[model samples]
Target chain A: AQSVSQHNHHVILSEAASLELGCNYSYGGTVNLFWYVQYPGQHLQLLLKYFSGDPLVKGIKGFEAEFIKSKFSFNLRKPSVQWSDTAEYFCAVNAYDYKLSFGAGTTVTVRA
Target chain B: DVKVTQSSRYLVKRTGEKVFLECVQDMDHENMFWYRQDPGLGLRLIYFSYDVKMKEKGDIPEGYSVSREKKERFSLILESASTNQTSMYLCASSSRTGPNSPLHFGNGTRLTVT
Candidate 1:
């Protein structure tokens, strides 16, 4: 069974602070990775996705993720986060299937 | 824009009652999914349909069933709702045209069983 692990349960930061949320997945085969964000009272939206080619993928809202196959990690990062970036972040992995396995999620609180 | 609309934003039902949650996608997507979102548990897949009249059980399908009578609609059914089944349900859809298509989600339906 494939599972995703998000290391950060909760993170609090001031505005303009650099952010990084760790994500790791357990899959041996070819995998597709995605980062999804859900704002307060809003539906989950795709932040970024990595299927093939570039390991470093840039997403919306100045967010990016690096997929390291050796580490089995795809960590989400932002150089400077804004107050509006406060949301729950989830990492999902699809290993040759229609179903995606999602991490527990990280709650981010950016203070102004 | 791709739109996935869930029938209800909120629902309340009694234990032993059957619950139906409807979802419709406008993109004519070939894949539809039902997931439950909880605080600690991010999103657990309950059921998915790859085509009309074709359904597959997901990780947590013990208490859930799905129906896909049409290409744009997927329905999740709970035979007997329980208090523990109270949670936010999200419906999503994606194109099977590509192997890595991202899922478009609905606003979600928060169901409470008492």
Candidate 2:
């Protein structure tokens, strides 16, 4: 079974600080990676996705993720985060199946 | 914009009572999914439907059932609600165009079983 592992359970950072949330998946085959964000009192929304081509994918809200096949990792990164970026971030992986397996999620709290 | 709407934002059900969590998608998506989100457990897939009236059991489908009579609607049913089943239920719909398509999520229905 394919499973996703997010290294950070909870992260706190000051405004304008660089951020990185580690994500690793267990699938050995071709996998599609995604970063989804759930803002306060809002539904979960897709930030970005990587299917093919570029391993480094840029997403909305100044977020980006690098997909490293050798490491089985798709780590989310932001050069500078804002207070508004506080939310629960989830890393999900789809291995060409109809279902997606998600990580335990990382709660990012950006302090201003 | 793609929207997936759950029937309820919060639900309270008694043990041994049958519970239904409804989901509707407006994008005419071919895939509808039911997931339970719990602390420390993330999102666990309960069931999914790829087409109308067609369903597939996901990772955690033991105590849950699903109905999909229409293309835009997928319903999750709990034959007998249990306290262990108390969690936020999220409904999502996606296109079956290989893997690039992301899942559009509903606001989620938080169910509490007593």
Whole-model lDDT values for every prediction: 0.96, 0.95
Cα lDDT tens digits for candidate 2, A1-93: 799999999999999999999999998999999999999999999999999999999999999999999999999999999999999999999
Backbone clashes in model 1, listed as residue pairs: none
Candidate 2 chain A, poorest ten consecutive residues by summed lDDT: A92-101
Task: For all candidates, state DockQ relative to the true structure.
Answer: 0.78, 0.83
User: Model 1 residue A104 lDDT?
Assistant: 94
- Candidate 2 segments exceeding 4 Å error: none
What RMSD does model 1 have? 0.7
C-alpha lDDT of residue A46 in model 1: 98
Chain A TM-scores for all candidates read 0.99, 0.98
Runs off by more than 4 Å, candidate 1: none
lDDT of 1 by residue, B1-114 (tens): 999999999999999999999999999899999999999899999999899999998999998899999999999999999999999999999999675899999999999999
> How many clashing pairs in candidate 1?
0
Q: Which candidate number has the best DockQ? A: 2
DockQ of 2: 0.83
Error of 1 at B27 (Å): 0.2
